[model samples]
Target: MRYIYDEQGVTFNYFLLTFIAIFLIPTTYFSLFSTDKDAKLRKPSCNCEACLRKENYLKNRKLSSTDRISKKLAIFVAVGWICFAYLVYKVTTVKIEIDVWDPYEVLGISEGTPLPQIKKHFKELSRKWHPDKAPEDKKAEYESKFIDFTKAYKVLTDEDIRKNYEEWGHPDGKQAYSLGIALPTWLIEAKNSPFVLGVYALAFGIGLPFFVGRWWYSSNAYTKDGIRTHTMDLYFKELRNNSTIKQLLDLLSASVEYKELVEQRPSDTTLLPQIISSVKEELDKRFSEKYQPSKRYIAPYCQKASALFHAHLLRINFSDEDLLKDKYFIAERSIHLINGILDIAIAHRWLQTSLRCMELSQLLVQAMWFQDNSLVQLPYINQDIIKTMKLKKKNIRNIIQLREMNDEERKNVFKALSPTEYESLMRIASIYPLLKIDQAYFKVAGDAIITPGSIVTLIIKLRI
Candidate 1:
């Protein structure tokens, strides 16, 4: 409680009445009610702590036209306050008033109060209102008042926040300097947004670990020995980790060179298995050599290995260009592609070749796992075709007649045979164990150099 004039006032009797009347007042009333732009501009709508304190000062000083309320409301509110103040003054000789929101006013202390004095006053007020000391009927009421006092004490005693309240009427004063409610100036002033920091954190913290883990998981891989290995691009003289297998798979997947080869399979179902198996067998034989592996070949080795792969594809009766240049085939049929490639690598017998083959094998296994195809898709024979051919075995032998046909005649014969018989019989010749194991056929194969446009015979030599 505070009084405009009192010698020994001691209670909030006058303060409560004064507090009610003060809110009814308005700052605009100081214009005597002129709201023109100039008047409004002259009297800004300030709610800063400075302005509120000034108003409180005026309210305590004396009654005057300084009230902020309109004339009519002021008349009613002022008369009502006067009556209450006078009644309490006569009955109790006590006059005290304080603004609830103003901590300085609530604590009955000036903004410039020293810390020691502030603490002393706070303790006195706290002890007076302590619930244990409060009257039974008024315990709850005193408890509420005690909370208000404690909050005020907390606000004023903190030097930094006290300064904030003195200047801005709020504990958090920096908000006054904000850009707007939507985005604070501090947010823009910062070097990076939280979102950008989050992305970097995700990449560095989680993404890096994931990539390394993937590399580690795929490190050890399948090799010609039918075992998994941790062989890196270089031999490790010390204990360390490597993950080349997954890395190679990623590169191969993105490669443009082997796109077609990865996807295309011979459309002739019966011939598909024969060509694939022949190629696989030959690669197996080349890789089965008993020799110590040397350090991988460099550029020169690459050229030789590449030429070998080309010839190797041809040996299995496939066009290298047709098979290795498609994209869908690479992405989808990588298993077959890797299988063939790895076999060639094993045949090379270089340390580099072995390592490269193991990497391809790892990739093939992973791709199969990814596509959920655990079992290899291989060519299957039809019983009907075998039975039909077996029934005509004698007739087939007679048809062949063992003639050394010229190129045109051989072409004509090939053209005459049904696609089924051509693929089936040719497959049997290539793979069937009971057929003649060792025979030789000689042909110039491509354009021959005799006299220009001269025809040549296709010669067959039997070594039985």
Candidate 2:
């Protein structure tokens, strides 16, 4: 007989046994009429004809219906068992719980928590269950508990740790632990002892290589061509060896003492000569070594230093309107230099090259505005040129307004102007005319034009 629960061996065996018993009973009962003595012994006799007839009728009837029902019940039980097993597997294998205490939930702490409170909490907890205070009998248990408590408390209280926890969850701690991330081994040894050093070294010996291997393989560097390229490997090696780029970045940082000094008194001309000379010397040194300037490469750090020197020089000359004109011209030239450097950086495919260039560009733009020369004008300028220049300074709304205007509206704004008014506005728009010497020249030409009512010819010329 075909077993419906064949996939489930135990259930199939049970159904097979039940079917055998049903068939065997009917065979044994009919065996009483058998001529063979062994068959006759296995059967039970019925004297009445009605009993014999009933028995004979049942024996003749087909058992296929009962077998089919049994098969269906076996299949149903097997399916139920399978579903139960799957549910158990899912519950065990895919379970994930986020049980770490959230600082915000427990203590109402958030980004705005005061540093003093954090420090105070750390100190109070550290003192209360310090390992040394535990009784001899419970020292080991207490110390373990205390350690876990302190770790959890420290992570929750610290701003950085709390932020990381919020982002990644408690499992992040286990990952960090497995990765052997912690204070530097040397620092830990100095703070604690050689035992700590030994532990760290052992952990690092196993973890560092694994971590580094995973990173190297997982990153783009793992490609066969990337790995085989000697120049690429050497570039990375040099980057790893040199600290000059970091030092140069540190010097240019907003928090640096030099940066503070320059900001506090921007017009301090005394420092300009020294700064310029130092930067030039560094540039010469780097160039002589055949080191190309790049955002990633250490050699280009001198360029940043040079840019800073020029920025400082611009600052010193910022206040004098005449000097401001000269400074603006210099600033525009500096922008070109910066663009050239960015091209070189891009050629090298320097890491963070675009970001560095953007940062420097922003700094230069900010320095340009420091002198209040935003409205300055220059000699021999055209009004159309001034209008174009104004487009550069316009905010999003102004830009949208300009964009939305029909050609006729744009033309009417600039057409039919007298030569002197056009020239004066042009000069006013130029950076040089804001100089003290040129200031008087602008006043003379200010009212030299009057619109003669929408000159169509002039509008066509301007629009075209």
Candidate 3:
């Protein structure tokens, strides 16, 4: 038997080789079957799982922990208990017995040793072999020895059993006693019923994760690729079909709501820093629970970002002598602000990872992609000392094409793009490939770190 010990010294029996499985096993059919899952709980303003949960909890102020537990965790607990009960029952029923041929030898006592002396040896041995203090790798060995010590202690303590053992030199007339209490007879006797164990094996075996992965992969594939299966042609098609820079150009165009959206913008760069400082002070006062910045500071963070977005984009000048510098200023400033917040969010356990933020960042990088790599490597200009580089309107338009396509006949299409386009895509992918469209391809591309959820969802691919 290969028994293992938890951090608290709770033993997992040798029969159930499920330490990895229990921790890594995905949630079962319940999560897949639920129609209104976290999709409904997601908040529109923020694109993070932690913020979503926090917002949801703040909205439902009246619901208690018990109500939430019953609605959410009850079914999970019940399903998990199925495997727990089976493993426990299997491991505990080892049918151990004290041979009792020599109680003196078992307890390390002489034939006529008094109870006090006998207990002295038992205490010393018990302390040495205690499972809680045993080495992690040698847990099972110590546990087995501890069980023997306990049974020896039990037999030697019982006067009648000791007397019989001493006189008969064996437990010939004694009835065998169990180390632990017997569970209900029905559960133990159900060993004869192959049907019961089969159900257990099926639910907890490799089969369960195999089924769940298929469900998850299929749904995600369809979401990103429509009816297309494993092949991501449809997904890549939609990906390349985007005209993000064109949309931004249209938004900034004089005709459509450009003047309307930029009525009166505020410039409060200090507001965000002040809010962050205030939240930090408040969080410092609390000692019981750790506070995450993202969860605590999201509202104020977004309030500031909304002001900056309009102030910059809406007021952008197409004819500015230093348009590229202005674009870089906006991008770098935005990146720094968000990156600072992201660092704080990641440090806390409550809010560490996000897929949507990564996706949006990647899209922005794509929109900002420059064909001339050397442009990015140019020496930094001293903004206050040097006049901005004057560039022609034709050169600007050549680098930044955002005009809307009329139709398929007139639309600009690039299949197997030229070396320049390919280089641009490679640059963006190298910097930010966080969307993780295909996990296998993600690994091959050298970007395969995935976040774990409340229930560690195991993704298994099966060929039928």
lDDT per residue (tens digit) for residues 50-82 in model 3: 234436544453246436755666566565667
True-structure RMSD, every candidate:
33.5, 40.7, 25.0
* Cα TM-score per model: 0.19, 0.19, 0.21
lDDT tens digits by residue: candidate 2, 222-287: 334222233234333332222343322322321112222223234435443454564455434422
lDDT of 3 at 52: 47
TM-score for candidate 2, residues paired by index: 0.19
Candidate 2 Cα lDDT to native: 0.44
Candidate lDDT scores, in order, read 0.46, 0.44, 0.41
Best by lDDT: 1
- CA-RMSD of model 1: 33.5
Instruction: Score residue 424 of candidate 1 by CA lDDT.
Output: 43
What is the Cα-based lDDT of residue 464 in candidate 1? 37
The residue-by-residue lDDT of candidate 1 on 109-161, one tens digit each, is: 88889989999999999889988898999999999988878878878777877
- In model 3, residue pairs whose N, Cα or C atoms come closer than 3 Å (at least 3 residues apart or on different chains), thus clashing, are 2-14
